[model samples]
Target: MAKKVALLQGNEACAHGAVYAGCTFFGGYPITPSTEVAEVMSVELPKIGGAFIQMEDEIAAMASILGGALTGAKAMTATSGPGMSLKQELLGYACIAEIPCVIINVMRGGPSTGMPTGPSQSDVLQARWGTHGDHPAIALAPSSCQEIFSETVRAFNLAEKYRMPVQVVFDEIVGHMRERIEFPEPGELEIIDRTEPTVAPEDYKPYDTQFGDVAPLAAFGSEYRYHVTGLNKAEDGFPTTKAELVDAEQRRQIRKIEDARADIESNEEYQTEDAEVIVLAYGSTARSGRYAVDRLREEGVKAGLFRPITLWPFPEKRVQELAKQTKGIIVPEMNLGQMVLEVERVVARDCAVELIGRVDGEPITPTQIMDKVKEVL
Candidate 1:
């Protein structure tokens, strides 16, 4: 039986997604544009027998989620731009520790508290390079309320599957928008749990890669006790400064995803195969890009959309392949051309790469995109 309900705000749907993905614990500090996620989690998690805690600050919020995940809980935390900044060091910790957790960043204007309530897509680069070191991450952006819920589930699944942190990056517009959503029915969705250690506790090496690319995880306080630190470590999970060991560990961390790229990527293309001009947009701007593509089609011009659901570990091969056929690529973003550069680099053939961007907290509308399509054509 399917049920239709009133529109859900994106933030609320995000919280629902986390629950559906089996998140048993949430630790976060409230901040504008993202507070609703915490608010809903507070009410819903307790009712469902999950733990919800409001930490003293964003740093504690991040640390608490990592602790929860270490104890075998599906844990997550949500924040906005400023809060995301505060959580960077711990973000890196989660990466190195290989903690399976989800971090939701509902973006607002930034640098440092530019506009707490306003929408901004300026976090694209931050989500990639915010952490200090060289660690790969998975980031998903939802353009609508339904995606907010669906992608949240995917974030948790990806994190647990890969034993790493995943990010759900949304902006204020999508976070606050209300839209009717129909969720999946029973048995339609697949959930993944973390892999457990197979070796005996006495023989277990926490970071051992003998079994496979992903080393099985043992929960904190388990008989298979081991230490986890941010510094590069050996198979036993002890801090090591050896260059060769460091190289191997780093490659293992990166290759876990690189080797499994097929499972990690999610994207969509509309009328792109036969179109000569394509628009690569993401987040909220994608909605308008769709409209612009439709308008161009109506005016006898061929335009298509390429939207990346997984922002990091970008779909480089796919875009490069598309570039071989397309004549031009127009990238529209809320910030001033961050992702465009990546597209240009990957699609380095004869295709022209164009940018349609704004950074003053104003949205790029369908009209502007339609015009850009014409200009690029």
Candidate 2:
């Protein structure tokens, strides 16, 4: 198959990737830096026999997708800063209820709708802990339009495979920036659908172990019918009041990701094996950090980049090794010290962990990252 090349924004590319990944339902509200995702899906979904709904608000948008996923549809929603806040409740619900879904968060400056149109990565910690629970989170960070598309597909795949909510975390710059990209041919990308129970309906359990940590999921309208509650549930997926069942289910919810940490973790290490200073970043910041590291390398500075593609798991082991080997690590991000905290914890007493962060609705330039890299070196 011939691949097509187009100049596309990150949000537009993500919508197309969702469609290609077998997304059959989209429910979203128009929010800055992310509304394009909904607009593109609205125009394209109907053409492909999928449903695109414009909900009244971000909260409703989150609810709609969760409901649609119950019927066995591959469903998703997109949002930015304030909208992400609105969806946190349902996000928790979806997490504990063992529903499979995808969320695209095009981050912007925030506390309260700080910069609707500007670039800022002020949602790193939020994506990890926005929902008030000890539930599982699988979030991916993409740096460019092509990366956004690929990660969006991965978001759906991971969600379906694990039967949990997965997030594609990007910033306002990547969401709106137009770049030329060659899309993968349909046959080039791998698509994963959720597993179904092989047993009869009467013998099925939505949250029970089957093969791996992930349990088989049967769509609600399918021959297999089961009940699930936001409260801690037993293997049968019903609400549980017993301490033993609650403890077992909650531990399993967390262990599913922790045990599979090796498979879920991803990062790109550039010249970090023997560097005096390592610059750490993700999303659009990684783009700037890349140029900074290359220029620093040209100027006789032993600087490298260790970019985390999977943000939730935090890529701690490699970072720990780098901290032990290097003199310092520089973390440059759009928000003030969110992920830097994690770096500090992991690299405690091994090496210095420094951060250059801004939340003023402007992106940190390569020059700025280079300056930090030079200072650290």
User: What TM-score does each of the candidates earn?
Assistant: 0.98, 0.98
Cα lDDT, model 2, residue 372: 75
Worst 10 residues of 1 by lDDT: 181-190
State each model's CA lDDT, in order: 0.90, 0.91
List RMSD in Å for every model shown: 1.1, 1.1
lDDT of 1: 0.90
Q: For residues 1-377, could you state the per-residue lDDT of candidate 1 as single tens digits? A: 55655578999999988888899999999999999999999998999899999999999999999999999999999999989999999999999989999999999887898788878888888898899888888999889999898899889889988999999998888999999977765445678899988788999888888977788899988999898999899999999999999999998889999888889888999989888899999888999899999999999899999999889878999999889888899999988778888898899865999998787777889999998888988
